[model samples]
Each structure stands twice: as structure tokens, then as C-alpha cells.
Target: MKEDAVDGDPFTTRDVGVAYHAYSASGDVTAPVVYAGSGNPSDYDWLTKQGIDVKGKIVLVRYSVPYSYRGFKALAAEQRGAAGILIYSDPAEDGFKKGRTYPDGPWGPESHIQRGGIGYDFRVPGDPLTPGWASVPGAPRIKAADAASLPKIMSAPLSWRDARPILEALKGPDAPATWQGGLPITYRVGAGPATVHMRVQMDDKVRPIWTVTGRLTGTQSPDQLVIVGNHRDAWVYGGVDPSSGTASLMELARSLGALAKRGTRPKRTIVFASWDAEEFTLTSSTEWGEQHARDLAEHAVAYLNVDSSTSGPDFKASAVPSLNRLVVQSARDILDIEEGTPEMLSNRLGGGSDYTVFLNFLGVPIVDMSFSGPYGVYHSMYDNHRWMQKFGDPGFVRHTAMTRLWGVMALRLANGDVVPLDYRASADRFREFIKEAVQTARLADLPALRPLKAAADRFAIAADRAGLRIETLLAGDPPDPAAAALIDRVLIGTERAFLDSAGIPGRPWYRHLIYAPKATYAPEVLPGVTEALEARDRKQIALQVARLAAALDRAAAILDGSR
Candidate 1:
């Protein structure tokens, strides 16, 4: 390493090393550097437009986008013959631009480097070798080298402080306006005067990870399952990410345990899970879900997940629309500790948590909630209890509130005679998604969107009619056991109808048609349709649109009690 004229250290420290999926071989090679902003697919497109060839260069990208996108960037770079990759967090996204630096405020300081996996979570999100199966003690595994989601090129995280010299030394065309960061120097798309030497090494071994599961059997309906889970592992202190959620989970367990001791229990069985290794692509949860796939699919009512429980005062929830009503009802029942009043939980939808397996893979309805406020210290040592006390939850009241809300929601689902699923809401949400997808597809001039639009309309009508029947049933006297069981089965089966046994095009592990991560590393409503359109693959577009339409039609039939 050469000493730069810069005052501070020009190399990332060993303490905050790079993340998973980084190539695990050591070799020294120096090459010219190129600045690739955010490292999103569009950013690569921009580089191509600028006539910049990253081939034989070591690309410098920002850690502003999702981890999966980082992997996409690496794959793109490798395809273009790039030698290596270095990722840094720009102040515009996580540093002083958000607020005062760490030690002064919650934002990251100059040397704060965000470490995370570059694994292709959109393709599959468990142990790489296991893929679609659980990584159990005797589970058959594939060779590590043959894993489809692993990166081929070396990658590392560089603190902005360490990146200053390299960025300043770059010689190329001025970067586009959107490519500029909060750094003081002018951003550039370089094939540079600056060169970087990169290396990476990792241990290839299979290790045991424990998933702590505790169950309380229901006296009346022991077969019905209500599961609530939060991951217990972290890369660092994890105060705002998993620790906060972990604490809330413990509190909920304590409260529930007390009720059970007093002989007051939920009508449906409850399972409390503290999953391990979620940070490495949702490992424990996915494995456990897969291992228990049969029983879960038959009995599980819903999965409620909480990660990064409270980072701020605003209540937010992401869920399949069938569970939206329960989320709303729960939020309305609990007092927002910050505001001293009840407020509606903001609706959000996407992936990046423990709920992925249950909702996207197993087709179980799920609701994930959090209270987020300026979170800049993610995946860093700075995310400690001290930081959480100062910026996340000052009095810990929000944690209690979250626990109470979770309990209420779980209890409501467990004890209700009728499963509280709202097909009308699901239909309405699907309609909205169709409109949005159609508009975006049209803008992209995609010819395959017509089928999706037509299918969504048909599903909407079916869903409305089904919803009316459910309402009529609920409004009358308590249904007989047979009728109640039929309604419950239909409600549970609706999500399952969306699953395609063959799974998505390239990622066989993710089977759901309604929800799956797109290539951009964000969750899409009709993932099959959106991903095919994004790839500009005419054949896939037609194929996925038909699959998505069929899934919706199946869901409608289930909800209408035809299946």
C-alpha cells in the first residue's frame, strides 16, 4: 500500500472487513479505477452510454443501494472484464448529509464503513450450497464452487475517508449530476490516473446455526399455529437492526408466558422463534421453514416478523393485503408512544427479512412492522446499545408498544372464529399494482403487459365477489364447525394458490408469483411479470405474464370456495 498525500489513513481497517459472497482467493493486481455510482443496473447503463469501458479496470462503486444490487454490479463488472470492485458509503446517503456525524449524532462518521453480503438474495436467500432445501445435519449439499449465486470477482468495502485519495486522483469525464455524492470533490467516471490493488480470502466450511423455537399449545385448537419471529444474530452490536427487535421478542414472550402460567392461553398454538444467521441471507428462518414445510403449510395461520423494531417514531408495516386489516386494527388499538395517540401504520411492501420464506415461498400471510427514523449506522459497530438509547428509542416505550401490538395481532388471529382475511383489500391492492405495472411497462414499450392487465381485472372481480360472501358469513350467527373450517381453509389456501411449483425463471427457490425480489433487489408485486419486462426478454415476458395471471386466477378460485 502506498502512502497518499492525504492526511488520514488511505486503507480500510481489518476490523470492518468486506462481507459475504466476496471472492475467496488472494491475488495482487493493480488496475485503473472507474467510478460507478450506486452500482445499480441503470448506473451500468449510464457507464455504457458514456462510452466508458470498465474492462480491465477496478471499479469503484457506492454502498448506497441494496446488497443484492451490489452483487448485480459485481456480476456486471465481471461480465465486462473488470478486475476487481471497491464499494464505499457516500455521505449523501449515510453520512453528514442526513445529520451530524456519529459521536455528535446518529449518522456515520468519516471512517464508518458499512459491511454487508453481496450475495444474490433476489435469486435465493439461504445457505448458498443448500439452495432450495434446508441446511440440516444430513441434508444433501452441492459443491460451493457450483453455487449459482456466489460472486466471481473479489470485492471489499472502503470507508469514504480511505476512498478520498483514490477518488481525487481519478482522471475522466465529469460524472452526471445524479452520480455526484456529498463529498467535496467533483465526481468523475474514471478509467483513472488512480489504480487499486484488491485481494480477498474466506474459509469454505459448513457450520451449525441454531434456531430457538418455543411453542405453547392451544387448549381448543392445538393444530392451528401462529408464529412470531425475529432474528437473533448480527455482524456487530446490531442495536438498531436485530437487537431492538430481539428485545421486543423477549418481552412478548415474557408477557405470553405469564398469561400461560395463569392458564389463559390463545385458542390457537403459538410459536416464538429467535432465528439465527438472518444477516447472511435469512438462513435460519428459511431453513426452519423449509424443514417444517409440510406441517406449516397445513396448519400455520400467519407469520409476524419484527426486525429493527424501532429506530424512530413513525409506525410502518409491510404485508400481504389479506393481513392488512389486522395490521390496521392492531395499530389502532395500540398507542404510539411518541405521539401519545393511536395512528395508522404506514403500508409498505418489499422483501429483506425473515418473513420471506413464510410469505413468498410457503404462501402464508405475513405482516412485518417497524418504527424507523434516520438510520445511518446500519451494519456497523456504531449500531450499539448506546446509539439505540440516544437515537432509536430514548425511553424504550416504543419497544413495549411494538410488543403489545404484536401480541394483539397474534391473539386476534388465533382466537377469532373466522380467519380475519380481507380478499377485497387484496384485490384492490392487486388492481393498484396492475395499474402501476401496466403504466411502467407501457413507458418501457413492453408488449407483454396486456395479459397481466386483463388477468388482474378478472381477479379483481372474483375477489370482490368472494369478499362479499365472507362478509355475509361473518355477519350472521357463529358459523358451524364445518363452515368455519371451510372458511379458514379457503383463506389459508388463497396465498398458496399464488405459488408456482416450478418457481421463477432462474430462481427455483422462490416460488411465489405475487411477491419476489426483482433484479433491482427490491420486492415487486408481480415479480415474474416485472422481472421479465425488466430483462427485455420477450419470451420470458409472455411466459411469466401467463403464469402470474394463472396464479391470480387460482387465488380467486380458492377465495371463491371453488377449490
Candidate 2:
């Protein structure tokens, strides 16, 4: 952990530093540090309206409610001409407000500083210099200055201990109720004498990253595949963040290897990968996904990701709706550590994992598995073995459960005669996404959503027809290989049809029209339409709705024909 402290705060050097990929201060930046609530654009806008401009001033923001990613906070501050940003965790967010803190319970200690990269990977993930393409041996590259995902302004993280002095020093208007944090001091929106020198210098360099892969070729069709992975890299010693999952991945690999030795291998190939640099930029996985884009598009059935396998005892999963049956089947087979009952699978996949590339970029069906609970030590040194053993995953029973669960999910896709992708749930979810966005944005008068709704309805009917056909084929005494192949193609095509080569309007690297990462790294369904609605740009909204409606129509037609 890099040490962090202010000139005025004379406590032990705090353990925090400027975030990865953020511009560092030239030397000591002695300036007035103003408080901006959550560092959101609206926060700055409010400051501007109140005649308190933030230009050339350092901003001290809390990691509080209305959860935008820290990178988004950095960008927001940069947008308003802030000289630098200091993001510190408020106890209400992930500290004693939750429960007893570290060394006592699962929450973070006063010293804990959440570490992470501030890169805008949601726009275009992977290597900044190699945006859309895979960065293999000699992949084409661009200057970091020209890269779309890189941050421009200086930034750093701070523990509340280090930030307390500065927050206490502020003199300004009382902050709104929502802007109050769990700190003892009263919150304020300031442009006062609370100025302090903020210094940062970084060693910005590109290092080699590796993605280790080993494929177990199938007996029936080696060309067909199922991919599974866990990211090996972590911000620190990521006990609950990734190492827990990494340990589970190793156990799963061993079990699978033993099965293969016994001459019981998957009918379709299983490619197991441990990706590097995932925590920083989600780099290695994205590169692998891009490098094999063509092959994956043609033959890949599903991707299973294991991340944070056990932080506590609540079993959870995130997946595309199309994989509901597969997830349900796998859950029924695995035992939950808490109740000793069948594990439960949660809802739609989010945007920040290795699966982002597979599902959003390559249109592969994906499921991300986890066992979560009070995980406040995320991205910190506190997330080490002791924390995991004492609080996260005591007895490591959950680890074994994860191993079995991960293997079972991968096997279901790899060994099944027919690709186990179903689109009925997907269609339902798509409609819900559209309706929620329209209602939330109150864009009921928007004209184009009518076609989008009709297209979604048609797609649902088509999905039912396709499901019926698959059921009959699976029930066949011996389904015709040619017919089964065609059905599988349609099933996979349903997912691929969601892709628009031009990508979500501004962020083309994220080609999936239905799902893409929001600027805050949250999963955005109907991303194109959702973003347009946020802008309240009717013409752009209409264009996005039409593009999505066309994709839905294309998916429906494929299902209709297969039936």
C-alpha cells in the first residue's frame, strides 16, 4: 500500500495513493480543497449555481450513496476543471455503520482505503493503447493521449483518517441532507481556507500481462466450445475480491483433469483460462476474447466466470436470462454452505467482469458466480488471508462448494448434446428493461418505443416456438444431427443478433446493442435507448430504438425459421 497523508495531518502516514492510470500531481499541489458531494456532475453544477466555482481547486469527495464508480467521480471532477480529486470512504457506506469494523467484524478499519484503477474502461475496456483489437505480440497500438479510455486529470484515494483534518478545516455552506456522511464532523460544500497541498507522481509504464489457457479437446466435436475463467490479478492481495475465486478455479481444474484422466471428458471442448490484469483494466480477458472473436462467434456456447467465490455465505450469480435453465440446473446440483440446500442463482449479469467481453462483446452467454456477504475489505490490503479465514470464508467449505458449482455449470454447457441457450427469459427481461427505462425517464410520449415493444412481443412468441422445437428434438429417439445442428445455430444466433457492429452509439467497442456498461461500470440493458433517454434527445432515442427493434426482429426471424 502506498502511503498517503496531507501536510496538516500529522498522524502515521496513511496507506493510500493516487489510483492506477490517473494523472499524478507534478509535485506538491498546495491549493484550496473544496468539498463536492460524491464528485457527481450535479454536485459541481450546484456549486456553480451557488457562485462557488471549482476551477483549479482540489476536490474532497465522499464515497457515499448514489453509487457512481470512482473513475466516474474522477471524470466528473475533471470535467468541472477541478485540479485534483480525493475520494475517501465514509463509514456509512462501508464502515462501522454496517457493523463492527475490521479486527472486530467484516467492515473496513479507519485505515482502509479502497484502491482501484480510474480508467474509463466502460467506454472501451482492455489495453488503453489497444482498444477494440487484441493486444497480442505486435497488435496495432495508439498513443495513450489519443486513447478514449484514459483519464486526464490528477487523482488520489484517502482514508478517512487522512481526510478528517481537511474535512474539518472547510468553511462553507451546510451540505444537503443527502450529502452528509458518517464522519463525526458536519459536512459542508466549501470554497474556503481548507486548502492543502496534494502531491502525486506516478511511474506510468506498460507491463506484460498473461492469460494462461488450456483446452480439453472434446471427443465428439472439438470445434464446439465452452469457456470458463477467473481473473488472477487483484488490486492488492484480493482475498475475497478474486483470490477466493482463483483458489476455487484451481480446485475445479484439478477435478476436471482427474475426470479427463478417467476417460470421462466433456463432449465439447472446455477452455479454462486464468486471466491477468483484470482488476486494472479487465485487460487479459478482453484481449483473449477479441483475439478469438471469430472462432468464439462461430462455435462458443457459453462462458462461466468465478469471481469472489466466498466473502460470506450468501450464494449469488449474475447471468444473461437465456441461461436461466442452465444456471438453475447447476444450482440444484451444488450445495449451499449456509443451509446445506441447493444453491440459488440471481439475475442479469453486470458489466465489470471478464464476462463483459464474452457476453457484451462476443455475444456469448455468460454466468458469473459468487458467494457474497459483508465484504468491506474489497480492493484493500485488509482483504488478506486472515480476513477471509476469520470472516469471509471460514472453514473454506464455500470454496469447495464453489469448485463443484463452477465445474457443474461449465459441464452443462460443454457436454450437453444441444447448446443449452434459451431465449424466452431474455425476451421477457428485454421488455422489462425497455419499460423500466421509459417509465423511469418518463419518456412515455417517445414515438419509437411502440415498435420496440411490438418487436419484443414478437420475439417472445418466437422464443416459445423455438423452445418447443428444442424439447421435441431432445426427446427424439435419435434427433437428426443436421436438424440438431440447425437448432443450435438458431439458439446461439439469438444472442449474436443482439450485437450491432457499429456498437452502442458513442462507444462502438461495446457492440452489444441490448447490453453494455454504463459510464459508472454498471450493467445497462437497452444501453443505446437508456443513454439516449438520459439525454432526452428524441431523435437519437428514435434512432437507437429502431436499431434495437431491428436486432430483436432479426432474432425473432431466426427463431421463427428454426421452428
Candidate 3:
């Protein structure tokens, strides 16, 4: 409840303010600390074997471990009894000398600290009070105490200024070279002579989350929906991460709104969302998606996301395999950036933001876009409008550029009579995956590698033949209904192949291709397949490729008006 608890002005407005007191923390406290390396749940195995207990202790976890998510979950399990949580950046990942520090360069200064949530266990996130539903007006809610997955105590962050004293006092094993940071003191993984008191009692107060949605209904296929979203909140002066993207979202809205006002409505309904609670692991979007899971699967066409936009030079996209080409062409048609082409800039997907819920859980095709190169000042006090003006897109020129790009793509998707998803490009991506899968299986000594390889070659040839036909259709005229439906359904099902009812090793909610699925939704998977554990994933992928080729052939026949 203190004024300083919520650090900056941007956090006050709930949507666009700077100070966010989601959790309680202290910077100046001196506490006896223990280093848990990556703080991973697996690390507990090693710690317990050494007879070291982290319960009733303050934990120091280094950032950028192999699996930070797993590490955080382990720390939270300890927090059911831990005194506090202290997370800091390791010099090896991103610290002084690797690059520049802020004001002087792009790296964080000594005072910079990393802050994040310590609860949820990669299962679900929100006001632990509300799960699987919106925290909207008059909604039923559970008490934080009854919230089984909630963290018992609040977590806070400390600057290296505070980290030095605690670390220096410790007397224990010299930390692995990989764990060493920029501090001159010998990094010892410790439980320490660094004894001091630490305490945190967070008020699990409920805060309102805003989801600003604006719609432009299409004239023809109004039932099909195209949604684009970006978060609008910041931890500090979040001008680059959320605000930069937030500004672009605003520009996109204004541009579309202007066009709609001129009677240029799309052929399909388009919804633009400015989400709250994205920084806290996409709470708002995920909860909303969970509440509407069934309806979204039935009606939604595609969801595109733009986060962390700045004046950075290169643009990158991580897409679900289904929309790979559609996303590529749109970026090419929209953005002016040149670096082996935007298509080449695309890469394998990972988890960080809102798209996880839609693609991972609901099986919706998604495209995530952002431009990242150098911004040393992320998640710190310096991530303000001034830093943005001086170092990022000053005066929002890039906002206009991005708006032009987002606008064109949204327009085409929302207005086109036939969904222009290029199945040929999709098949190409599948072919590439087949090649990689074959290599991986050979390396792993898995059987049937040759059969998979032969099947992939046949699929590739079929794809090439289909590619020529689809290209001719694009060059001549849009495909007919039978063709369009065949292509669209195959596109949807092929992308959905990554979904397994079994989900990931620990988390069942993430059933998507590239990221972790949400916990509340049922896994999307192929029907009638024998549910056998230990079946080769490469086998499943190859099977899906063959099915996709068959669907494409059927689509070509339909589009040619021969069906």
C-alpha cells in the first residue's frame, strides 16, 4: 500500500502505468542466502542428496538456466517454506562486458534486478483466486488460501548492490564456472555466513485487468473471426517491450477504425484486443481464452500477435506451421526490412507471451511478430519513454511503418472470399521437418528411419505437383468452395497434429506445436490412433505429412472444378 511499492507513474492507470506491485519485494535487505544454481526442480535432487535444505531459507537463483520455467517452479515449491526469493542475471548470459550497460550501453547496470512471479507451476496463472474463468464483474472466486497451486509467500527482487553482500558472506562450494557472475567475489553456491533477516507478506489484493476490444464486421463471411492482440501494461517505464508494441496496436486500431469509418469494412469480422496481465505470463489472455475455449475453436480463423516492437533493425516471426507461408507473404508485402527476407528470419518457437494459449491449447493457427536486436534496458527502470525516444523508435515512426504492415494483412484475411493460406508452403515446411526428423531418428538409432525417409520423399514430390497447381490458382483466380474448404480443413488438422492428449512431460495444458499448452483445455490430437506410449514422434509427423498431401490433392481437384 506504500507509494514507493508501485514504482512508476505508468502503472497507476491500470493499463499504461509504470509501477506494478503484483508482488512484495525488498532491495536493501541483507538475508542469509542459498544458491540453487538454476533453481530448477531437478536441482533439488542434488541439493537434498548433499543434505542441504532450502526450506526456511532465502534462495538465490541465477537467471537463464537451461529451463528457467522449471527452475522457477522449483523455487516456488521451496517458497512454501522459503524466507524469500532473489533472482539475478548471470554474467555469462547478459551482463557487463558481453555488451553495453544502459545509459552507457545496452546491458543492465549494477542496480538492475530481474523481477518475475514465483507461483503457477506452469499449470495456470492469475489471481490464484480465479482460475479457468475471467475475473470479470461479479464472478465467483476462490480464496487464495484454498488456491492449491498458489505460492504461499510473496517473491521479490534485489539489485547486485544487495546481492554482493549476501554472496560475499557465504562459505560453501565454489559455484560452477557457468554460474559465476560479474561480481569480483568468488561465486560460491552457499547457504551462508551471510546471515541476516528477510521477510515478505504480500497482500493478495485483486486488481482489475482491462481487455479493450474493438470490432469491424465483415460484409460476407462475418462468422469467421480474425483477432489481433497486444498487451498494454508495463512493469516500469515499459516503452520498448509492451509500450512499443502497444503503440503499434493502437496505430493498427486507428488505421482500421479510420478505414471502417469510411465504409471499408472487412468481409470477415476483425477484433483488435489490447490485453492486460500479459507480462505476468499472459494471465488475462489465457484466462479469457479458457473461458471461451469451445467457441473460439468453432469460429476463430487466426490470431496474430505483436509484442516487444522497437526501432530494432531486424524482424523475426515464429509461426505455427499452418500459417507459415501466409505470415511470410504478409510480412514481405508489409514490412520493408531486408535480411535474407522475413521468411528466412523466421525460426523455431518458444514460450514467452500470449500466443501460447491460442495455438498451444485451442489449436488455432497463430503468427507472432517482433523486432529484436539490441535493447539492454529491458525490464529495468530505464525502460521509459525517454530511453525509447533516445534509443528506440523516437516519435513513433516505426509505429506507422508497422501499422501499414499489420493493416494490409488484417485486411486481406478479413476480406478475402477464399482464405489465402498457401498449402504448398506449408507442405514445404513439413518436408523440412521430415528431413530433420529423419536425421534425428538416425542419430537416436530409432528403427524405420528409411521407411520414414522414403515416405517423406514421396510426400515432397506430391507437394511439388500440388504447389504448381495452387500457384496457378493464385495467378488466375481464387479457388472455389470445395477447394477452399479442403485446403482449409487440412491446414487446420495438419497443424493440430503436434497436439497430443498426453501433453508435455509434466504440463498437460500445452498441446500446441511450438510452446507449452494451457492446462484447462483438453489436448487436441488425431482421432482413432492407438494411444500407445513410446510411439515414435517422427512416425506421427510423417503420417500427418502423408495425410496433408492427400488433402491437398483433393483440394486441387476441387479448386480445378473437377469435383
The best candidate in terms of lDDT: 2
**Candidate 2: regions farther than 4 A off:** 1-28, 65-67, 336-347, 438-444
Candidate 2 per-residue lDDT, tens place, 58-166, comes to 9988875545678788888888888888888878888888889876789977777888778888888898899989898787899978988788777888777778888
Clashes of each: 0, 1, 12
Q: TM-score for each prediction?
A: 0.90, 0.93, 0.77
lDDT tens digits, residue span 106-194, model 1? 88878776666666666788888888888898899998678876766777777788888988999788988988999999988888889
Off by over 4 Å in 3: 1-31, 41-56, 65-83, 90-95, 125-149, 152-154, 338-344, 427-445, 448-469, 475-506, 513-563
Candidate 3, overall lDDT? Answer: 0.60
Alpha-carbon local distance difference test for all models: 0.78, 0.81, 0.60
**Alpha carbon lDDT at 275, candidate 3:** 81
Q: For model 3, how big is the CA root-mean-square deviation?
A: 6.1
Model 1, C-alpha of 33: deviation from truth (Å):
1.7
lDDT of 3 at 378: 58
Which pairs clash in model 2? 32-195
Q: For model 1, what is the C-alpha lDDT against the true structure?
A: 0.78
Q: Rank the candidates by TM-score, best first.
A: 2, 1, 3
